[model samples]
Target chain A: MLNHIWLALIVIGILTAAGRDIHEVSQNSYGNGIPWMLQIESPQTISVYGEAVETSLRVPRRQLQLHFHETAAADAVIPARVNLTHAREGVAVLDVTGDVPQQFKIMAEALGSGETLTARLRHRGSGWEAEFDPVSLVYLKKVTNAAFDIAGVAVQIAIGLIGIMALWLGVMKVAEKAGLITSLARIVRPITVRLFPDVPADHPAVGSMIMNISANMLGLGNAATPFGLKAMEELDELNTKKGVATDSMVTFLALNTSCITLIPATAIAVRAAAGSSDPAIIIGTSFLASLTATIFAVTISKLLARVKMFRWDRSEAE
Target chain B: MEIFRTFVSLLSAIAIPALILFFLVYAAFRRVKVYEVAVEGAKEGFDIAVRIIPYLVLMLVSIAIFRASGAMDVFIAIVRPLTDLVGIPAEVLPMAIMRPLSGSGSLGIMTETMQAYGTDSFIGVLVSTLFGSTETTFYVLAVYFGAVGIRNTRHALPTGLLADFIAFLAAVFFVGVLL
Candidate 1:
């Protein structure tokens, strides 16, 4: 019974992690549906063989087996392996083996036409024992291009960004006025007191600016920018002199940038969009990338502010 | 406008009690430290995060539904040629760039893309790999800047966006060469 509790906790922890890894939902596994085949046709064929005429090659369905459909006298029919060549050169899109044998090659009848699987068969009683056609042996060369897929992902993400932005903007206004519009906040901060309450109301502009940044940091960037800019105009009232960017502005920017995320929800969304098996990788990458970017940005901006260069830009505009 | 105004008014009314309730929970939990108090205050903010989860899940499901429903596949079929012209897959195209903008939405599209094409296929692998490595620079920059109150996406955005372009080009070229 020694260390019973500790051992039990360790076992519990292991089980939790395993469950997290291969997250099975009620929906579906990776490839659940591939239609059964009836007939297959080779689009093109080239014979380096000195002989000819045989039965169609035997190729399996799930396992893609290759059997010789060659002539009985030529002895060309059998299970064998072969190399497949693509029509294009410098295009690294083939999964053919280096030195193929009989088993790798399947009968032509195995892969029915109107389907997507096809293989080139070759049997060499010589050196490399691999199949090679002057032209490509199969019809496999990126059925879908890469660039277009990325763009499609980008568009969907854009829509999500917009939706989040709009929602966040609405929420910010609600969170802010939650006290001002009601008698409850008055009970808390004293309703008999004034709306100005000493934090220095610089127009609803500055307050809205702060809220804007807060919302974006909350991952509502689509809706935050305009509100933030307007807040600067609000904060302008506080800078009655030559009109310069204040420490609060820089500090606010720094915090927003460095706002440690609660959930890497957005990156997860991207990973899902990208069709990754493990979309959770976004959690780690997002933390590291966002943290580094935010720290470098906020720190440098603050340091730059100490010098005249930082303040001069805004003041000069004033 | 009336609905908006009423909602705002309602939230204002509720916020005071919410703050108090949060404070009471902190006290009850024996967390009177300033840091804990501050964190407990953030727990109120944390509640908003939790509320957003249903949307995230729904969005992902709908994306799956879209692909399963064949709308996304058809969309990709139309997009494939155009994307092919630029060296991308129609299915992978929307998600590659958009994912950086919003993770949840991109995930939905990603589900669709993977369903249409073999996820292990060269382009699928490349897009998935790149999606992990790349940053949604604009969204991150915008949010971070806003959270802390930086106003100029004017310069920061350009640099970040340019970096994004470079990353995109590099991913395409690398996959073309290697995979």
Candidate 2:
């Protein structure tokens, strides 16, 4: 299932990118090879042909409509620096900053530069004729960049986990050696017995699982991850069929993914940052919602375990 | 309600320090040689993290591709009608689809949604509730199973996805009640 889903994402992404690029090309979405007319507002008139001047260019509503093919395109004023090598021709660098059209911003990005687009300008009758660099295959370029970037980012995320993973795993080791984990498992035996019938009541896996779920409920996400990973390692020790997930693993994950919420700290923090009147307003709602999902998640995991396709005995782990 | 909120916030703040102190002190009292045992246990952390690299790289790369190509818009377009039939708000459809797939993507969607709508509006509250209620299923599946080198995840994916869906529905229902 994971193999199929993983393949589907890549195939869908590449195909969609190709399709959008083709559609944009057919529609001349970036207005390739088109010249735009603009009014230049320079503070001083340049007598020397090779002089550079700071100016503002005003793009008319009609030019915007003609280029973007959108009737709602409005007039825009852009700050620019122009260096004229000849009386009739110059290179104008338009600073693509605030209030710029979305298409222009995309075009600037596709040109592989920062927030500045360099365009060739010619002195027309009463205005400057500006021709921008062509932009095509925008979506495909984005998809390619994203794939390469995230591949490295994935390694960074894993490397970032080393310190925290070590800390919590070390602490958990002490708890296990002191017999604190077994005792913790004992206290939760009645619940663990039903949730994970395959494991012994006082097993260390149960202890780690309890610690994970408790940390998760308290919204201690940093602590929860190491304990959760520790729990997986302990659970793996009990697996008869290596490389395959056990019913107990699925049950634990189900519980983890939809664990009951007491604080919902991240959401509240985001709300507060967004200037919410009552950032913690969703606490009750999140709690009730997660509680309902947790109940259903456990039930679903148990029910699905009995299905023929997912039956533990039928699975052939590599 | 206010007091409960304060208590939970305080508890979360102190949980790790308290747990560490209790575990170390208790282990010391038990004559367990806490430092050596902890260092020994920490040894596995590097190996586990290295083992997860290949899995995490592939999983995150695929998700990034899907997001960057804007296939989610197409996916949401196809699923919108079915969701509308069930009375789920059209505006929050992106959040529902993204909640389980990517954490940062959903965070961006949540912030964008709240900015488009008022922060205290029903849609804003609903999206935030949805975000708070469920975990990022794909990420968790990759990291956890990858740690143990589990290749055949059996029923884990489906179970997590179904739970996320239920969480979304429950969020909508509860947020409605709250309003």
Candidate 3:
């Protein structure tokens, strides 16, 4: 199912890009000039003509055109000597002089400084004029570029997970062997009993349920899967309805869905790999969110079980 | 507020290492062959990671394609008004929607979000919190329940959806306060 959807998306992306490319061909401005949308992600100091000034720039400036009248104020064009540099693939780099600092400040302020800003540029005699925040230009770039981006990210992620997953799983193994899991399960025994009243406290399902929840809380996804499956199978053994789910089954699913995760290690690792300054910062917020979700899942499942629409018929006991 | 943020940061810094230390010491006291068990567990972990790669790749690729085709942008635009009312940023709508459907998909989206917004940015933090807190409700249901041949899922779908909804709101709230 997913494979088909993926294929469809690829086809659609190619078609869309092709259609746009065709329209672009028809417009055929080439060197003659057409309106250009400049997307500036951030502003920083860049070397332009042996001088440094804060500006929005991309290197190798062949197509680089500077007319501040678009995203910047109508009168914000600075009277500076434009020094052009190399440009590649329709991107350019350029250095400008004259009241550039003041002009750049005005444009930067209008561009919101820290966020992505888009400006419109159109032919005006030998130069161009630009406008701000034209929303129509926002679209995902080339599908090939996105595919490359995802491929790099996926491999990076898979590699990153290896060490951390190994470390935590190894510790978990020790804990399990030491009977730590059972001890941890004991702490949540009362709640599990109430949730799965049909299953005996000593049943394997109960132990598996506790272990599954604990693994999830510790952000152990791979460890959680087997235990969760085990619990489901164990719970299934006691089910009188062969193909139908029991109340305990539904409740267990709900609980598993909202299990509290204490450390978002995977998320943090991805962030860290992406060069986040503080990778662990999301942990606290994640904990709070997971805790709330768990409360809601457990409570809502219990409440929904009592509703007539969801109540199981005990009269059809096998 | 600054102090609180610092405290939270310190708490996270210490939590995992502390937990590992406590487990090691406790296992030692119990006289479980610690090194052997750890190695064995690590092997299992390795196997699980290997097993998940195909699924991860498929999900990630699908997400990449969906997003690259501008479908995600359209989806976000459509839901922006409703999300705005609930304080969920438009930036995180993909993560929120994908969370309950597929784990790898949500993780991929979160990675993309972090890359786009900068990991420390508010939107990045919000998406990460949402990604970490929620489960792949539909995937879990299909995999586990289907494995047992339970054709009737009863209230699991609704309950899971409810949980995901609460998780989305909670993430927005917690990130707002703490991050």
Candidate 4:
């Protein structure tokens, strides 16, 4: 399944890039008009002008580059604001000064289309002002971005995973050693038995499955993966047909895949790192959402098990 | 309602410590040799982490390719009209699709969205709630089922997708009412 999905992404990326480049070859110019949103706090008159350039089509594609020149009297206290806006899309606000005129480059998607770009300005606490004239910006068809992004993002994520996985795995070890997992398994045994009717309550697979789900709920990601693997291996031991997923396996897999997470520690950490005012605000809503999802996942798997097409055929596996 | 809110907050504050303490206390009472067992289990962590790296990297890279190729944008544009009617914001469509595919990719997208839109905005809450609620279904399937060598996944995929769909809707609904 994943193999096909990966192949599709690469193929679509290459095709889209080739198609767009083909169209670009016929066009006279790759530049699009972008409107600027300017704001100044000082009383002195100010004028700003700029053009966008296409820097590179290689890995880490630099889609657009903007060079803007502003002529204004220097003031230490007064604030200067420059922002790009699209009608339906959001705004990207930048603070600029005449002292150091740095070029700006942003993702092409963030700036919207070439035609609809608008610049709005606000002066000295006045309402937002707009310029009808749009700045000419160049566009590029980045066909290889996906390929590069895949490689780049993989390295980035792998680096992040190393440390996080180590920490969580250590904590999980402590929990498992302390007999917390078995205690947790015992507590949730009733629910687990009801969910997986085929699995004997006393079977070690049941305990492992509960531990996996518990680890998931506690947001012990690394721990959960191992427990899940162990659970599957144990469950497979009882399977009548090797290589064919039994009803119990399907149920367990669905529940593990859609389990409700009580503490979304990773999300909270990311939000807090980004300077969110209240990182934990999503907790209650997220719990409710996960609960809904788990219920649906369990119900759907059970319902689907009854369907003739989805039913397991022991002979087919052979 | 206010009291319930306080209770949740209090619980959240103590949840982690409580869990840790419960384990320690239980093992101590049972004379389970906590320190030795903890060390023995911790030893397995290094190997498990190593084992998962290839699968994790594979999923992450594929997701990056999907996002960078602009196919996701094209797909989103096609679905916008239909999803708009369902109140699924266009801003969150990337997240909904990627949530099942890759954990890191979706996290990056969520962070980017929160940066673009203020963290307090509607989209921010919706995505954050989504990130909190949903699991990386495909990753789970590949790692767990693949470990057991189960080729005939049967109803697992559909069941997982159904759960994700419910999670998406629930995120929107609960955030709408609560936030």
Mind giving the per-residue lDDT tens digits that candidate 2 earns over A140-239? 9999999999999999999999999898899999999999999999998999999999999998999999999999999988889999999999999999
TM-score of each: 0.31, 0.97, 0.55, 0.65
| Winning model by TM-score | 2
Rank list by TM-score: 2, 4, 3, 1
Candidate 3 docking classification: acceptable
**Per-candidate TM-score, chain A:** 0.34, 0.95, 0.45, 0.53
Stretches > 4 Å off in candidate 3: A1-188, A314-318, B1-72
Pick the winner on lDDT between candidates 1 and 2: 2
TM-score of 2: 0.97
Candidate 4 vs. true structure, TM-score: 0.65
Model 1 bad stretches (over 4 Å): A1-214, A217-233, A236-259, A307-309, A313-315, B1-179
lDDT of 3: 0.65
Choose 1 or 2, whichever is better by TM-score: 2
Superposition error at A198 for model 4 (Å) = 2.4
- The digit string of per-residue lDDT tens for model 4 on B64-178 reads 5555555677788899999999877899999998899777779988999999997878899899889889888877776666556666677777788888988998899999998
Q: Residue by residue across A66-177, what tens digits does model 1's lDDT show?
A: 2222222232222222223343111111122322223222112123321212333333332112222222211111112222343455445444544444443334334333
Encode model 3's per-residue lDDT on A1-318: one tens digit a residue. Answer: 223444665676666655554554454312124344333223222234344233443211233233222233233223222222233122223233333434333333333441233343343453444344422111234466567777677566555656665776677678777877667667677887888888766565777787677777766676577667657777989998886778888888888988887777788788889898888788778888989988889889888778775677732222
